[model samples]
Target: MKQAVVIGGGVVGCHIALELAERRYEVFLLERHSRLGMDTSTRNSGVLHAGIYYPADSLKARLCVEGNRLSREFFDRTGVQYRPSGKFIIARDRSEISEIEALRDKAIANGAEGISLVPQDTVQKRVPCVRCVGALHSASTCIIDTGDYLTTLKTLLMQRDVHLLYECPALAIDGGVRVETPRGSVDADIVINAAGLYADEVARMTGLDDFTVVPLKGDYYCTTALPLEVPVYPPPNHGHGTLGVHLTPTCGPDVIIGPSETPSRGKDNYDIETPFAVFDDSLRDMIPNYEAIRPSLREGFSGNRPRAFRGGTRCEDFIIMKQPDSVIHLLSIESPGLTSAPAIARFVVKMI
Candidate 1:
């Protein structure tokens, strides 16, 4: 059996480890933190995206759709708690209606299922408090109990006897595929770098430094006032790095809003606050009864996205490639990464 070393213990890394273990590889999963899914995987929105927003030809578009299916199946088989609550992309005015239509066309091109444009009456009937001219309803979108899902993956990996080392950070790589850690070095036939925010640094340790990871911080706020049954989102920002601050109904009763995006100097910069005015503005723009719910909005946690840049230019697509040695790197896995984890694991397994 070939020895495999998978770095990072986020959803992507966990999935990759599980796949490798099933293939009978001597897998050892390494995580810098004491527990898994503590970073970008558990932070931000837990929505299982319908794969509507990405460009048709991108890896995100393809893997997200397939991963959605695989994730649902995995949840069902494993009895993981998830809700297929669906989603609505709202157009607040005439100017935004065209963008919604364009998104609908793109969803069709990307093979996203159960998507349709609903008129104002349907929008109002579905979500009375939401103010929008029209909306794109994606019935396939869902929300998962991310904690439960992560626990399930860890349990499965443990059952397979996969060596999971927590609090063991990879310091460097020597002799091509040998991984150096605080405890000692591990020689592996294949090395997979899935280190969320530190992926670029991990790749550099192996002499692959063509790209850099830029940390994009996003802050979310919680509110129970505008209790919608499904996720509500504005039309995506035209040229921005994020999907815009929006509302997402968790698998539980409480609703979340305002994951405002801002660039950060480093990965540890999660101290920023979500301004009340910004959260209020985002709510007022989407929800009709903003004043009534404005007081209920409370600050939530923040997360950093490992956005990849090559030659100082932002990379919109995921970078899943192999180096000259047997080092496979997954960089810039931001949004939809949670939804795309299963397919990405299969892709990497096939490559190996």
Candidate 2:
């Protein structure tokens, strides 16, 4: 049996550990925190995207599609709460109609189905609160109970008899040589760095150069009311280091207004304080219904996205690079990352 180590206990790390365990590799999962998914994975919008967005050729295009199918199947088998609520990309004005059409074409190119251009008249009758000249409707989209999904993955890992070391943070790494916290060290033939928030530090410790993990905060607001039955999205903001705010409905049927774009200055910045100014100008303005929506009238929270410094990076696919000699690093894994979790894990396991 080959001994391997996976660092980081988030969704990617835990899911990969489960895959490795299935393949009979003696796997040890090391997490700095006491529980799994306690970091960035837990702090995200539980969106199972419909394989829209992104150019057809990218991994975001491929992995997202594969991940969505596989994750949905897994959820069914494991009894995780996942709902295919469907979503719409609304164009509030004629200026966005062209872009919405382009996205429909792109989704087709990416091998996605049921993506159509919805007329403004239909939008007025179906979703009057949301003003739009046109909208892209993708029926393949769904939302998952991310918390329940993570807990299930953790339970699966433990049931497999895989070793899990909680509160055991890695202090240093020289190749496969790692000096973990307390009075201990570990050497293994394989090491995977999926430390969502701190994935950059894990990579640097292995002596690889030329990469940085920029933390982008995505704030969310929640309401008890299932205001709009379908999720509402706007034409994405076409700007560097920026992203547009959208609305999402949770698995429990509550609506979430959110994921505001707030870039982080440094590590350990898990601040959830509401940015009243940004929220007022951007979130409320981009999605007009937010002003009078029932979700806006309820409680909410925020999460962080481990994004690359540039906004273009978010549109790009998740980065999984192996050192060739040894040590594999998964960087800037955000957005559809949760949707791409299983496929990403399988890809990394094969690389190993």
Q: How many residue pairs clash in each candidate?
A: 0, 2
Deviating ranges (above 4 Å) for candidate 2: 124-128, 177-179, 241-243, 282-299, 309-316
Show the lowest summed lDDT stretch of 10 residues, model 2: 308-317
Q: Please write out the lDDT profile of model 2 over residues 64-155, one tens digit for every residue.
A: 88888889889989999978877788887788888899989898999886788988887667665566777999888888888999899988
Superposition error at 104 for model 2 (Å): 0.8
Q: Write the per-residue lDDT of candidate 1 for residues 193-229, one digit (tens) a residue.
A: 9998999999888778888898888888887777688
Per-residue lDDT, model 2, residue 170, is 77
Runs with alpha carbons beyond 4 Å of true place in candidate 1 = none
What are the RMSD figures for all models against the true structure? 1.1, 2.8
Q: Give the TM-score of candidate 1.
A: 0.98
